[model samples]
Target: MSDTILTLTGVQADIAQYHILQGVDLAVPRGAVTMLLGRNGVGKTTTLRTIMGHLVARQGVIGFDGMDITARATSARARLGIGYVPENMGIFSDLTVEENMVLAAVSGRLLAERRDRIFAAFPPLRTFWTSDAGTLSGGQKQMLSIARAMAEDRKLYLIDEPTKGLAPAIISTMVAALRELKDGGASILLVEQNFAVARALGDHAAVMDDGRIVWSGEMSELADDAGLQERLMGLSMEGK
Candidate 1:
């Protein structure tokens, strides 16, 4: 069995005239979280978006579960068990929480066990199941976003900035939920700004700069070295 669930090799992408993702390479190990960390505008989100097929890569290949999916449409990628929780959270404000989850399910049905698992991780989703998603607080919306993706038995998850603007308590909850998700043996490629949260959930770390991966190794190695953190993620380059 392959240890890697996803691989990006020499990937390049462009947005209009703006060139992004210049020769990016990444590998996400199966059943572990790999944190993609970098400064703002460093193409971390672009990397995830490229992997999710939200952006067409102008060059190179994207492989998922031993198959090349570079030319696959976004929906096809999703159906292949690669769940994406974008940076924006991608909530449907007008839709009820149940409706939003139903849409995220993709199978057109939320199975009992899946629903139970989602609720166990995010209780707020159950609280406002019939309510409009916009009525929920920011933390609740983030929880819903994660719950929706996690509702299915996915082989890999690409989560971008899951805790960007959350309160500490909510972040703690988010961390706990993600830890539980990791414990369940799921592969995740996470883009997190909070180093603490990244350290907590990531088993491996990939640091990006100038649109390419500059470092890749165990998360603990990065977390344990403050000097290295300062060198790679300098004072001015610490977040998204």
Candidate 2:
């Protein structure tokens, strides 16, 4: 098998009349986390969406596990072991936490082993097991979103902004859970704006600029070089 679990070459997409993802080239290595970092409006989310087939690519190829999935439906992609936790959380407001998990599991049941794993990682999920997802706090919702994606086994996870507006303590929880997921041999393509979380979880780093990946390297290398981070991620990325 190829070392890369996911690869995008010259991938381009359009949102209505506006063009995004001019030519995004990225690779998520096997059993590692690849951080997708960039300034706002730079098409980082678009890249992940395109990969999941939520947005069709206008050009280029998307390869996953040695298969070309560019024309595959979103559901087909999910069935192929690609989990997705989109930016909006994508949970039903009226659904209880248990119901949400049940729906995400695809098997219509959350198996004992997976349930235990998720509960151990995020204790709050168990605490509010029967509560409506809408009643939970933002951090809890985010946790549920992640757990939903992991409800079943998956080779690759496409996660967008897992810590966009979370507090320090909750972010730490997210960091820990993601670390566990990464350690458990899952290849992740993560869109995270929080540098600390990205640095902690990412094995590799890819930076997008103006709808294209401008830099790709080891996460440690990017963490150690402030100049490179500034040039690729922008001034707002300073001290982040």
Candidate 3:
């Protein structure tokens, strides 16, 4: 098996007439969290969309678990153990929390064990199990979105902006939950704006600018170097 669970080589994508993800070469290591960081409109979300096959890549290759999956359909990619938690926290507004969880449960698997694990990580899920997902607090909804994608066994997770717009306390809780997931050996490709959260969860880091990756290395190195953080991201790690 390859050390990297997911790899994108020279990947390019376009949404409508505008080009995005120009030659995005990224590697997500097995059993580790890889942080994808960038300013707004830098194609971080586009890269995730391309990997999920939600947007067809106009160029380059996507590899998962040692196989080329560039041409795979989004459903095929999901069936192959890739879970996605979009920035919008895709959940059914009218559905109860249990209903939403049930809907996201992968086929042919018993859900009790995994559901237990999720509840353990985010206790609010259990508290609001019977409540409408839309009625839940923003933090609770975010938890549900992440929980939905994690309901089944997955080789990798593509998560976009889990902490965006959250209060510091909620961000702390979210950070703790993600830490548990990471500690449980879940490999994740996370796009986050909060440098503090990224520093807490990321093992490896990649930065993007103008649709291309400009830097990548150990998260600790980036965290320690405020100057590099400013140069690469156009802001100091803590201030942003």
Using lDDT, give the best candidate's number: 2
Q: How does candidate 1 fare on TM-score? A: 0.96
Per residue, candidate 2 scores C-alpha lDDT tens digits across 1-240 of 239989999999999999988988888899999999888999989998899999999899999999999999999999899999999999998999999999998677999999999999999999999999999999999999999999998989999999999999999999999999998998999999889888889999999999999989899999988888877776534456
Number of the candidate with higher lDDT, 2 or 3: 2
Off by over 4 Å in 2: 236-240
| lDDT (tens digit, per residue) of candidate 3 on 1-240 | 239999999999999999988899988899999999989999999999899999998899999999999999999999999999999999999999999988887784437898898899889999999999999999899999999988887899999999999988889888988898899899999999888889889999999999999998999899999999989988786544
Backbone clashes in model 2, listed as residue pairs: none
Error of 3 at 13 (Å): 0.4
**TM-scores for all candidates?**
0.96, 0.96, 0.96
- What lDDT, from 0 to 1, does candidate 2 have? 0.92
Of 1 and 2, the candidate ranking higher by lDDT: 2
- By lDDT, the better pick of 1 and 3 is 3
On TM-score, the candidate that comes out on top is 2
lDDT against the true structure, per candidate, is: 0.90, 0.92, 0.91
Give Cα distance to truth, residue 49, candidate 2, Å: 0.7
